[model samples]
Target chain A: MESAIDTHLTACPRTISRRVPDAYQPPFPMFVGRADETLHQVTMAYLGVQYRDGGQRTAALAAVAEIVGTFDIADGPAHNDITRHTDKEGYVNLIVVGYWRDPAAFCRWLRSPDVNGWWDSPERLSGELGYFREIVSPRAEQFETLYAFTDNLPGVGAVMDDISGEINEHAYWGSMRERFPLSQTDWMESSGELVVVTGNPADGGRVVVQGHDNIALIRSGQDWREAGPEERALYLEEIQPTLQAGMDFLRDNGETVGCYSNRLVQNIDLDGNLLDETYNIGHWRSLEKLERWAESHPTHLRIFTTFFKVVADLDKLRLYHEVSVSDGANQIFEYLNCHPSTGMMRDAKVMASR
Target chain B: MESAIDTHLTACPRTISRRVPDAYQPPFPMFVGRADETLHQVTMAYLGVQYRDGGQRTAALAAVAEIVGTFDIADGPAHNDITRHTDKEGYVNLIVVGYWRDPAAFCRWLRSPDVNGWWDSPERLSGELGYFREIVSPRAEQFETLYAFTDNLPGVGAVMDDISGEINEHAYWGSMRERFPLSQTDWMESSGELVVVTGNPADGGRVVVQGHDNIALIRSGQDWREAGPEERALYLEEIQPTLQAGMDFLRDNGETVGCYSNRLVQNIDLDGNLLDETYNIGHWRSLEKLERWAESHPTHLRIFTTFFKVVADLDKLRLYHEVSVSDGANQIFEYLNCHPSTGMMRDAKVMASR
Candidate 1:
């Protein structure tokens, strides 16, 4: 039964709640939580380098290693990881991901002479080497995290103390929104357009595109390394196929449903060997459309039904996701010598030079 | 000299032209051209799978291999490549890229029982395995390609007959836009907001977001595998540092300048080893802001100055890029069980349930 307060809290009649049914027990205990209060805002920074060819990455590798070393020391990121990936153009991306529990610390690190000097160095203009850093800081209320197991947690989990025990909010369509603390009062509505606030490409040099408000970002992860052979078989054979279909629908045809881009990626080791984890990173125009996909799409329905069918027997599988709605004022969209179809460039407006 | 006809062709007085100075030769005679005319509209598709963990990827690998085998048919793509990468969430991603010279052929293949059945199969919804396919088709006029060398051409290069010799347009800030055919007349301005046309996240269902018009995309590449030792040194030591600095400016602080997201990625082989190629794929709000970065920003000036100083000795360095402005209607972005901070979600709008 819904209490008057609960009803009032979720003003929208159709809105879901994060509160679990009274005395309801989950088939398997799962956990999800956020960073400590000290981390009122979390900052994630990806500093990377792109070499023209793989044969000459020694210098680039050393560059990132040094930076990683710097971040590993005191007054640095709470957690950091070095990862690799190759893009459609056959570019190898070496990224050093650093998570800061405090925005002030992140800002301080950025302004530090060591970091600024490295970024401002003239040697970075090599015709064969390219470098970049992408940083985002979201308030505690803007983002959420969930974990399947306590070991080997990624992202904000590094700064978090412990995995809070399950308190409902799983196996449902609107559960994600319900999990978000922001849903209490704010609808998280989107505002503004992907409008150009500066020069156009025709005049050519560097073009900057401004993003809209409340653009949504989601990183859904699944870690099932500890599953027993039988549960693993069930997951691999039964649940996985259904999940793939839903992901495939979004990857190939998500534009129809408001998805901008979706990548179903697996985790790997330094040796290019596969790891025991995988995740789907997607960008949506708004949180509403993402909700609609989960609530009504046939693709997701199959995923929903398939998971529930074997929920009782699947004890080892770990599933969790985190979603954040960003402020447009904090967003960035710039292109250098890149393809016009890259990223937000596909849909942003081109304004005349200011 | 501006021919009367040329003046008439370029309606915008402020727009730059692709024509080079009279009889002016490039330092190393760089080459750039488009894919063969046979490819009126090119379609690029990426088919991939995501597993719960790396330990259980044997099945996923076999699945992709089977699909790759099928795509190798005579009626399949004109070219293809298999690549790998790990994302921020530590997910391993295996991608099989296929390029088609004809969109109709791509359509035909998508509907083929072999491909269609594979995609539509109920077995794909497994809880542990996720699959996805991303496809994009751009008309000949909508895209432009450039190459520093003839060998190891990527993207449309596989379909091209030869690397057309230098035709004069080189070494300029606005060169990318000048290289684009659409820039000759069309301003490529954006025309819509990222609006929600359906259900909100609160509704707990699938929601569809609508995109606007005239979004741009760019794929700028650098292949220095064939560069001489001295040129490589110049690139690795002198030129690279400066380029990295500029890229860093965009990556770290580009939000203030209008960039949505930028990734400087290198190309890697299957073994997770670095390759001899690299590129930067960026998403901008518009072509205009990109131009501003290039034209007035000091970061790009260093890139331009450094290249000019060493242009004479850089004989083996290969640098090329392709830019395209997409129709927003053809775009797709969706997220399922993903972290909220992924991709364009950082600044998109969120509408209420309709």
Candidate 2:
């Protein structure tokens, strides 16, 4: 039965998996046999310009802020896995990550007119720019993922249910493989397994995985004091459904055995901004298993397709994946212990100081 | 007799001479030697300090201007190598090059009361100051030399006269060797033969030598309209002498060789502020030669000893060195037809435009 679906899916060139091990199987029972599914990882980069002149610098910053404000998640079926950072005094770098069913569906989003319009915006001008360079190589060469820890668990039907619900509602990833097939292969071949572990390591915690290039911890900020009541309510209501949808997709198509997941709150900075706010980090038995889930799973496909459509017009919101190899711990202890400086955290800290 | 001199000079750490294959002794007994007799390269970084409340930037700029104004040949010896560039809004970056007997000699002048007092002077003080950070590294890597193209047909009498004159006026080599024996060996070993060519490749025009890692050019800037009469006179009378001294030192030391020297220049800003400036970039036939010079020379010893004495009291000065390798043609094209850029070239162009 599983072989039958695999044959059927092979008809779609965009949905074809690069190399799937014969022993591959899904963690959960689904409509299609686990043997039939394919998975792919995708990464994208969004560069923000910073001009040398003060006036132009101001203009660039404003444009970036405006773009970030327009990020939406309801426009398509794509799933979003993204992170953003800025050099205190220089440029802004954004990385977006997610999975896809195949390359064909991914290509449709790249050629979209919405993305082109943002690049051609009138306000995107630099003053006396000295260095303006861009680089795009396979994430495998650029970075490595050595460590990952999370609290969510596989077989928790609730999480998988949420993921499927979100995908069905948004219909995001179905067409991406045909549109951006190359991107899917590039990401899958380059990225490593996403490791998910249990517990908060910061509050007298320990990491389950020993060697990883990057570690993303997932947690909820329900206890965070800086968030106003209204803000907290709005976040829980809006994000829960989306997050549930993601969980549902993973439960149905993800592989089990040697897999892990974790849930944690976001890290915050001194300025009340989100530091590292990844929704969840999951560890697969191998990259091969992750690829399978991404390729043939309908729920996973819908999540990603919707994500790209929502932020397609926003220049600041980028989607990319990085595959890094970490020889030793690159992150400092101080960075790991601190919450990002959000208003809730700042207020709580102030109260404690007093 | 020539063999005897070669034997003696070869043994003398301070003296370097290359034997002519067939001594058809021209008008002067021409014995080629290495240039940059000072045998030391010094690098200094100037940092401007500004206040926390935006006053620091202006203060830093002013301090930069003040430092640039104090450049002079008598302070030590300059090699006509200086670079000054500014951004679009006319902020400045100034680098001055010159040669010194050693770091001690350079530092004493740098930290002298006269130089330090300028920082406190009411007219110059902005309550914002700039400082120097010194870095001294013996050149032990990335050094090479290629010597060619010289006037070989000069009468033996003329050559002898030139050699004798050099010996009489700058016979400091003997005592210098006595004081610092190790400094002399590296140069003696690396010094190449003095070849007399048929024509002056660098005569009446500019000779531009550019390589993968190095660039050296000598030209007449008589027509460049970048400076006023005072600046022009200063360039001709004051700057020219120092430049000539360097050229003569190179000619006497070896037929043609490369050595590090100091960079010196008058720091003039777009706002027309003048700065007192002094720094060094020692050169040698090779990195080994530089290292030997640093370890052995007595003049260098005395110079460095003096430098540390005043360093404790100085407001600022810095020194460091970087070694680089080259592969492509190191020597660029020689322009025999054109005159160097003097202040007059701009005026001629402007008049023509009118």
Candidate 3:
């Protein structure tokens, strides 16, 4: 294979030749867990990138390239990755999202010697650099995830399994089956593929075929520098108003629809300059409620439709959507030395054990 | 005064009408104590601006309007105010810079019933709301502040006294009196008017003339929407790089020369939108050290020189500079549940008694 790749690249100028490994394993592997019990927790780690000058530099970003460094560590999460990286001048940001099979197990690992030495090291505590962390255990049912394909699971999805090994079970948009089926489908239309991985009957639950999914994702163009009057109009006349109204409607209405939180993110360069990409991650209590809001909700349907159209025409810009669901036992969250607005921390007692 | 406003507006029919008070007092008051004491502390309060929509409507802003409400309470500092208010869309920023005679007193208030109840309330705990507080306590000698004139104190300056009550102090730029002397001159250039509030010889120290002052403040025009190519260059080539580098120099070197922390603030509406104005608040251990950096520091000198040139040429734009020096005792700091980057939180433990 190495010779073949080297020879192949020789035919093309400017193509560097390198040896390729013939036997390969996925950088991150699926979770190893008990067959009978429910075991999983969601973990989100917030890491900061420190800049020296013109270059984007930080140990945190570099650490991300070493994928699954802690995957095999005892009591650690089943999966982890530097899921998000954003940069601005003088500062860079890296976010690691992962999932544990058990909340207690993850906590134990956190207090263990290896983890404590790294996080609580004297050099780290020096305070010269900036850093923060947020850990959440999503009550399994509290979340819904949709993937483009069964082979790839992101963050928490990597810790849990689908209902079946193949795409045999049919799942609807707002049904219970959509979240945890052994074999899953891209019912939310956000995840790219439709293939499914088999699941264990003894483990948690499975996604049974329902009908359709309700979760709606709104993504703007990747670049909007030439964002003329038309682009601004989309934000002002359509996008902004729709989002504001939707949030208001959902909050005022109720929680059955699965909407729990709203998150907005924008990409940035090392200089902290704003990027063209923006993502809105909203939580839904259930897919049915999400569907109702997407299909029947008067204001939301219009807003989402317009967003879809704007992205359709922009060639340089790309948009994506996804949704996922978790069972109660597999979800978890922990908020530490943080502000009141930190997820669940406001009401959570300071250092109080539940 | 009321009639004069009415007469002046006669040329413009659209002028609004409201009665002006004949007698007025500054919303925040000076510290009360014996004069011979060190009598200074640095306070930086991060107050959240709640967002319902696009408006800057927030209890935090409203609370700031009622200045020094907690100053009189026992264990509370003699003065604190929402000294800095900057806003952006969906968020409002309020910063209350204050000083405490004793750092311990500030900690007492944080744990007291009044502050805890308001901050720890259920409404505040909801993850939907954003809230954070950063407390920095620079040793008295660790910080110096400069104001354009007498009678105006921002953050910690509000705690210390100026040179004279009647504008008699002739303090110059780079004079020791700018920071520690009983009476100070308009060394900062940002504070308006050269007037002094009468000070009791027994109550704390005054801005005594020792030598030079450090710390620079930069403010552009009221709006930057039309900030053309020149403006962009100033930020890209001069302002941003200089600011970033200056911070690096201060941190890399020890605090002997008045270099401690770098602060850059932009004026914003209640809605948290950016304003044209920007303020740089850097802590200097001493005035002479600050002067050394200002006059000799390669990157900073270049930055300040360009800033001076630009502000000198533009009529619509405004630029101001000031420097201050404080004693160790009066320069107390209190940090509560905050990231290590917060003033001294990295060294200060959570709720730990010093």
The digit string of per-residue lDDT tens for model 1 on B1-354 reads 112122223346533233222333334455565444465677767565555556746776776687787785546998876655443445455556687888788888878888878776766653455555545576666666666565767866676565665544544334555555566555566665455454443332223445555545555666678788887887788767777777767666766766654545566544445677766655566665565555445455556556656655556787666666566655544332223323333335676443
Write down the TM-score for model 1.
Answer: 0.43
Of models 1 and 2, which has the larger DockQ?
Answer: 1
Q: List runs of model 1 lying over 4 Å from the truth.
A: A1-29, A34-36, A48-67, A85-94, A122-125, A129-132, A150-152, A195-209, A224-254, A269-274, A310-317, A332-342, A352-354, B1-354
After superposition, the stretches of candidate 3 with alpha carbons farther than 4 Å from their true spots are A1-354, B1-94, B99-112, B116-179, B182-241, B248-258, B268-270, B284-291, B307-316, B321-327, B346-354
Among all windows of ten consecutive residues in candidate 3 chain B, which has the lowest summed lDDT?
Answer: B15-24
- Give lDDT tens digits, candidate 3, residues A1-354: 111011211233322111111121112111211112253334433332232333434454454432245546788667654423322222334444445656677778778787666555555434333333434443343333432233344445456654122121111112223223211222222221111122211221211111112222222112343456676556556666666566556544434444443444455443344555454444454443355445434455455445534643543223334344433333333322222222222222232231
How many clashes (backbone N, Cα, C below 3 Å) per candidate? 143, 180, 121
User: Which is the leading candidate under lDDT?
Assistant: 1
Per residue, candidate 1 scores C-alpha lDDT tens digits across A1-354 of 112122212345333222222332344445666344555677767565555556746766776677787785456999876655453445555666688888788878878888777666665543455565545676776766755565557766777665665546544334466556666445676675566565454443344667777777777766677888887787788767767777878766766767765655555444445566666666677786676566445455556556555655556677667677777765655543333333454456675455
- Position A89, candidate 1: lDDT: 49
Candidates sorted on TM-score, descending: 1, 3, 2
Chain B TM-score for the candidates in order: 0.74, 0.28, 0.44
Residues B180-297, model 2: lDDT tens digits:
2222332223323111122222232222222222221111111113445654555456444544454334333421333332222344443535533322233333433333333223
